[model samples]
Target: MSTNNYPFQLGQDQSRRKFIYNFTKAAGVATLLTSPVISHADSFFVPPAPVTVGEVMDMFINQVPGAPFNSTVDTLKAGNRDIQVTGIVTTMFATIEVIRKSIALGANFIIAHEPTFYNHQDQTAWLANDEVYRYKADLLQQHNIAVWRNHDYIHSINPDGVRMGLLKQLGWQSYYNPVATNVLMLPTTSLSSLIDHLKQKLFIDKVRYIGDLKQNCQKILLMPGAAGGTRQIQAMGKEKPDVLICGEIQEWETAEYVRDAQAKGQKLSLIVLGHIASEEPGSEFMANWLKEKLPGMKITHLLSNNSLSFL
Candidate 1:
């Protein structure tokens, strides 16, 4: 890719403000107001306004207009209510570490990008009798923490909150193609050089690779979190990108397909940035977003420890 070929141009200060304004307006109040409610026994417990979980969720969906909520394992945790949520914390997953962080920050409500429970759907029915699950559940109950998931919602949101956050962190805001978030035309650089740059820029340690690093390709397709199905595969074939930057892949599916493609002499390479690494930036963006939405509420973002180790 030519240096001149980089598609985005950073806007001036005024332009950036306008961009933020437009982006927020486009996102709408629904995404901004989808916070958890709180209840208190004392006069101090009363919020300025009472809001329900469903109502906040609806608002979030409306604002984003494209978040995916159907596959969400559970919408609201077992015990949650509509009161004024005092503070909010956005996290990739509500692990033991995350819960502790939320409490330390004085955040009572958690908006998770992934599942609170282990599974994608976050079903705990089978774990009812399981000791480990019981222990985790009991901890939340003791803490008075309310958890709501925003998996599909963030994915479906326009510009994709996660992807947007990653791009912003990389200072690649102007490089996005006007046509789509996945398609980005960046300045000319070798694959290895780009990888090194990403490591430092993203501050990550577990980036996996599938394909030759020596290959030079300008147009890159970034499918963060996880790569999709056969249709997406076919589309990638058509695009014939130099590289596909993704969060993670199923070894039997996307990884296998990429291997086959390489054997067939395709020049494409797949860079597997860990799922959490790929999605964490978006969580950071969510913190900023929540701060804007609930100005009075304290918001913080917590990152998951990277899951991969190189031998």
Candidate 2:
């Protein structure tokens, strides 16, 4: 049979007939041949567009309760937005070790809570001739990794995502009130016991504290990150918590304030958890949230540990 010379397209007709026959036989119903499955067979094989960096960012920004802010530090610090994201890594900071780990894990996008560079704004112009900056920047370029700062957006969320994550990690959610996000009313425990608990929970060796070891602590002023000494002192003044659990503090500010208060017979204390240890939970929370939003996509939380060694 000269099929090529036929006026009617014989191959398409045979394919259609064969498809219907198979579909009917598999479905066990002859009437199912008229179903939309036959018409959609072509489209069923078409894969979805690969998720781009910009698309993921858009989805994230859109989901944030009151996002699309007029001004934000949450900008792409490295790499372009058009590239497709193979995987995501969330961390407290995109240190060189973390960046290398991300590369090893086959991740192309990094959502870091803090700046990648040594500055808050991540300005790289001044570091154009610096060796350390060049090395880090070259590593990112070689791996085609994109680093995006998520500081402002995460902090802007209701109840503060970082604080919520810390509460969850420390099992203090029961005592947390959204209205008073900075306060946690916990069972009465000694200051030393609380420090031990924090060290265990946050996976740290030691923490700098300024209170009598046996002093009882029930109310906690939860300031995870560096909220500045003035803010910390002011919050303590207003909330009057038994202990202030904060990240980092200047030598002369909050510490001196607590010292003066102690001299005056006021029951005040402070525990420094370090910046990374305190906010790492928030990045972990981000990883979990991303998994829900991007089903089937690989998302990991990398611990950006402090480089300083403790005796």
Candidate 3:
């Protein structure tokens, strides 16, 4: 959607004009506003009063360069990028339920930290002919919703948005290092007790562990949202952390390595908090940033339904 066909009337009054001007300035796209307001006949391609989808996407990527995922501006389907996004909604995953919630909040632009379509890449290859995928994609088209993934951008930002959220939620901001996105020191506690505390505090059900709870955990390495491969796992071991709190891990890789450490009698622990729970905080941070950047625009946050059910 371009500036010409903006949905909201920008030339109504002085206040409206000021609002648009300030919003464009905050978005760092004031140069695009040569004309006070522009309109287009393509109702499907509604642009936000003062901002464009490209600008919004650019703002997010530029602000959060360290995000873990990638985004694509594709025109594969009709009405995909035709929406004029007034407000922005941030979420871990842009599932159907989340999309519905965004629409109810009057936010047509969605900035998702994870994939909208099920996979990590948000690709629709397998769903190219799938009935359910097609229906979901069509629903988005009908509503004129424009979805963008801000994963990689957020991760690339110094300190990493996800890690920052985790630290904020844990009240460990003082311990966090902005340059390395690592914690200097955490309160000393038993591995088991720390696990229990995290479960109770986060109110999460799927917290899994891979160490002797009785061990005293003086130092812990935390990597939210998926453990790295064997090489990185080995490096983490060198750090001599009593425990490693990671979001998720492949069953055969980090998970098994932790088991091996246990077998070898190393007093190391691994806590798996699932990917969604690990990354949820970042979306909340995104919402706060949106509020700061676009003061006039209404902002809302939608959370993904828990994707895993354990026996």
TM of each candidate vs. truth: 0.78, 0.84, 0.77
Better of 1 and 3 by TM-score: 1
lDDT of 1 by residue, 1-311 (tens): 32322223322222232112111111112222232564433232222244454555566677766344455553776348663465566777888777877777766777888877788778889888988788878877787778888777776777778889889866778888757668888776667766765665567655778865666758888887865656447658777788888877777777788888889988878787778877878877877876565544455677655645777
| Candidate 2 lDDT score at position 195 | 79
Strongest candidate by lDDT:
2
Residues 1-311 of candidate 2 have per-residue lDDT tens digits of 11123222223322222111011011111222345556632212222237988888888777678788878889998888997997888888899998988888778999999988899888999999999999999999999999988888888877678988888777678888878888988877778778777876677778999988888888899898899999999999999999999999997999999999999999999899999889888987888787777765677787777879988
- TM-score order, best first, reads 2, 1, 3
Candidate 2, run of 10 with poorest lDDT = 18-27
Per-structure clash totals for the candidates: 7, 0, 20
Sorting all predicted structures by lDDT, with the top scorer first, yields: 2, 1, 3
